[model samples]
Target chain A: MAHHVRTDYGDSDPLFPSKAAVFWYAVLIAGLIAAPYLLESYYLSQLVFIMIYAIVGVALNILSGQAGQVSIGHAAFLAIGAYFTAVAQKYGLPLVLYLPLAGVFTGIAGYLVGLPALRLHGIYLAIATLAFAFIVEEIIARWESVTNGNEGLMLPPPSLFGLKLGTEGFYYLCLLVTVLVVLAAINIIRSSTGRSFMALRDSETAARSMGIDTARYKTTAFALSAGITGIAGALYAHKMSFISPEMFSLSVSIDFVMIIIIGGLVSLRGAVFGAIFMIMADPLLIILKDQLPLWADMVTHGLYLPDSVNQAVQAGVSRVVNAPGLKSLIFGIIIIVFIIYEPLGLDGRWQRVKAYFKQFPLARQRSARPPRMFLKSERR
Target chain B: MLDFTQQLISGVALGCVYGLIALGFVLIYKATEVVNFAQGEIMMLGAFMSVTFITTLGLNYWLSFLLCVIAMAILGAIMERLVLRPILGYPQFSIVMATIGLGLVIRALVGIIWGTDDLRIETPFTDGVFKIGALVIAWDALSIIVATILLCAALYAFFRFTRVGIAMQATSQNMLAAYYMGIPVKRMFSLIWSLSAMVACAAGILLAPITLIHANLGFLGIKAFPAAVLGGFGSIPGAVAGGITIGIVESLSGFYLPEGFKDVAAYVVLLAVLLWKPQGLFGLNAVKKV
Candidate 1:
């Protein structure tokens, strides 16, 4: 019925409703609501993880997408937030009261960090932030009394309104928080503060010349981004029921960057796309792994593979397939291809496609400049 | 007092390793104005390569060390041509993001090959501790410092005396003018990468024994990054000075300060220094043209 109804659909006919787009969103919302009810506890937990990651994606977008601040050490802020929450919980502060407080502390750290970073632009700032990240991890590892060092301290399930928020309950919590966050972010980006950030992003010197306080705003941008990221971190710690330095590594930081790039860097829609892309990519890759043939079998059992790689590949394929590194190698190749060719990323490509469809009925895309003959009589 | 001297000697020796890595970063920045963050990963590879050749393939340590430098130089050169050249003259952010991608790819490659093994190499130098009344210093420490001085001297001569080296310097000074003089700017760019990679390899080969070689040895990349900033991003001499300062400061702090203060003390120094002197000790303040 849908295929028949959508046979003549194109961008030119705005009056004609696209059932596919409508149905996709409708199905997404329905599935999201029903996920906990339908799936087992394990799958529900994964979804909760995805939601937390989405929050991270949103926070990072505030810095990179909106403010042109390239931070690769955001995971440190997460660690700060998580540890703060843990400490708060351990010290008998109510979980709900302490979570937002953790974000405030993280924001303060971000602002302080940003102050130094602002003095040194771009690459220099990145190096400083990277140092901050390493230093944070080292402290977390060394401070046994507080962080319990590498062994990690555990947190009981967060209780909100006298009901313990288990994984299924956390899903609802994450869901509610995610909606509020998404709406808040949308509003913020539409507000004056967001515009100032975008302006600063596009051109700092020009923005300043036009009377924008680039310094104050840059720090504020960090505060806003870090504060949100901190909140997500606090939430994430409770969601996992455990926290460790290994969970927040340089690799995870890169994961956020990769997500932003694949989805879109400069678009709001990109955040959604990025979060979905990252969350879905792992399982999709796993499924793809299960579908491979000859070469896969040999590589899976290659004698050269170390214990970890062997175990991971064996687990992912289960029935004997390709090496774990092979999947990563494929992912690497794709990133290489994207960085080389479509540096603007998938969103940019999507815009061009939409433009092409918009011009289809006319058989030519309209432009201000006309044919060669018309150019000669421009003055007349 | 004896422990203090030993700590100082050990810090300086370890710092020489950071200095060498810092030298690589400065070289890359000098030539192309791009910092190769994957430098630590490259250092990691160099150490792993030396390990693989010496331990696995029955090669002498000295021979493997020399070959690793040459191999890293080639890798660096290839990286410039392949990954970096394509993104030439883009915005700093784009170039940065691209290099990070390159770094990830390189890390993954290293992991695939080595499989995250913590490795060890037989110390090529004699293990002896020298004592002067109250002060004690390991032979490796003194040797590493001496070796660094000799290496720095050789590099100095290369840049000062050789044609390509002078061309590289000129290119670093002003790419357009160098091109005008028929310098072949592209060659200089690749030459910078090759030189930086060699420097990183040398650092890795020297420091592998002391640090206990591992894939995570790359973490020092970030640590040494502060050395670059501290020395001033564009100054070669600054790299050495910054590294030694950090090393001594780190060691002394760990001893003097209460538990956990030493870890962040380096960054605190970095922040303080950056706040006080944004151009760094050796770095020239960038003149903003209005």
Candidate 2:
């Protein structure tokens, strides 16, 4: 095995890290671009959703992961963006105009919400965001004349530059936007702005002492995060073609938080990984539901149990599988298990695996273990 | 004036339920600094358990209530030991997420076992109504208020007079000092969970008659957040006061404000309160030291 050892500072300064990394990035992007041809419409649509959710996950990572601000209500931003597009479509606005406007409107909403966040910290801020989400949902429902109330709004097929986008075109569009957003995120993370956000996360008092404008940066984080999420929401609305207040409820907000946490906090790759996991998990579960009974029967065939007992067992399993809340139940369990066992998330696990391979025979068992965390008193 | 008084009584009764739920939140937060987002789910479970004891098993109402409370207390203790104990030292965000997960799990399990249909529990006071002047109040609402008052009194007595309660208080005040003083701090945590769970069960049973028992009943816990926060996160009395204030505001808004404002009244007040006084009405401000 050969290592690309950096002899000069400039060798390690580029975004790709090494020639091999650049090659891998090229291959990944090529594969993604070729996906529409390789997969059916159903799978292609799923990929579009994965890309869209990845945008939200990346945006949330900027706030919660880099800035250490917990938001249990990011779905509010998504709702605002989606509604912006929906309402804009009603007024006969073009995709080019409404799409960016969606982000701008949602960014303003984020700025308004972030105002109270200056005085609030930790759980208080979380609660404030929660309240804000509820208020937004209520406003959407009650302000029926504009939002269509509970009836929801219908979106026309999206087009760009007077050209109608088919399913494949939409996928490519999402791919293009996702690539741009990821690149922008990378630049932000490497820049002074990202460094200041990280400083604020580590400690506000320290960041303030270091002359970082904590308030301005905090609001900046909220606006930037909300704006990115808004863009994703605009795409999402066009994809779904219809939107309702019920679609952007509290659970959606929780899902965004789950994405970043389960993907791995503080790592950009984690956001993409988390989005993939979240988007794919639904189809995976459905597949499991279909195959589970056969698998159960095969394993139990050797037992030769009574027909009645076997039927009862199969019925029980089917009932559990068919339960409406099973998906959320499994998601809840996964979150708990991850929080307890793998707080660093899927990205952390990947990093450890990479490190273990890099060290090979030299790797110690304890080397990959996370540091023990002590109980930090919330009391001042 | 008549309609206003009627709404006020109903609000107070609804607020008492919120207070009891908020009490559960405050108890767990005070002892462990973990916000149990599943408190409402626990209350839902309590309601379902009572329904099983009363309607399914044909037990007397009072007997079933006692049994439900005891069962929920054990469940709470077990929950703390199993899920919360291992993650004690993690950041507050992880714990909050875990509790939210717990809530989702509980809701699902209840859906699996009981099915998702709404359930009704018959109480002795379900049909009775009290007529005073031009106002008519249902016995269900009145009983909720009375039960809440009694429960609060009992809890006050327990904390003020009992050795275990004092120990729990000590643990909440300063966990390290309490451990140094030979108090079984871990046990105190388990006890606090059980105590809060017991209170939650009582609230659930009281509330079931009014709201109807359903899996989504736990979402009421969201409303209780405003109550708990308004009262101050850790203050027992504050939780109740906050709950009542939210309840009154909600009821009044439902009547006086435009449609749909009632649903978000608690949250609106919560945002306002958070903006005005982040420390809460009863919470003492603490400056962080770097």
Model 1 per-residue lDDT tens digits across residues B167-242: 9999888777788999999888888999998988888888877777875788787678778889998888899889
Model 2, span A1-380: residue lDDT tens: 46777788656555766678889999999999899879999999999999999999999999999888889999999999999999898898988899889999999999988899999888988889999999998899878889998899998888888899999988998899899999988888777899899999999999999999999989999998999999999999988999999989999999999998899996989999999999999999999999988877876676888888788889988889999999989999998999999999999999999888988999887989999988777776
Tell me the lDDT of model 1 at A146.
90
lDDT of 1 by residue, A118-221 (tens): 67777777767777777788788888889999998798989887877777777887887776677677677777788788898877777888899889988988
As a whole number from 0 to 100, the lDDT of residue A104 in candidate 2 is: 92
Considering every candidate listed, which one attains the maximal DockQ? 2
Question: Compared with the true structure, what per-residue lDDT tens digits does model 2 show for residues B1-290?
Answer: 99999999999999999999999999999888889999999999999999899999999999999999999999999999988888989888889999999999999999999999999989999989999989999999999999999998999999999999899889888899999999998899899999999999999999999998998999999899999999989899999999999999999999998888899999989999998999899998886788
- Model 1: runs farther than 4 Å from truth? A1-31, A38-43, A90-96, A142-146, A284-335, A360-380, B129-134, B258-263
Candidate-wise lDDT, in order: 0.77, 0.92
Deviation in angstroms for A51 in model 2?
Answer: 0.5
lDDT of prediction 1 = 0.77
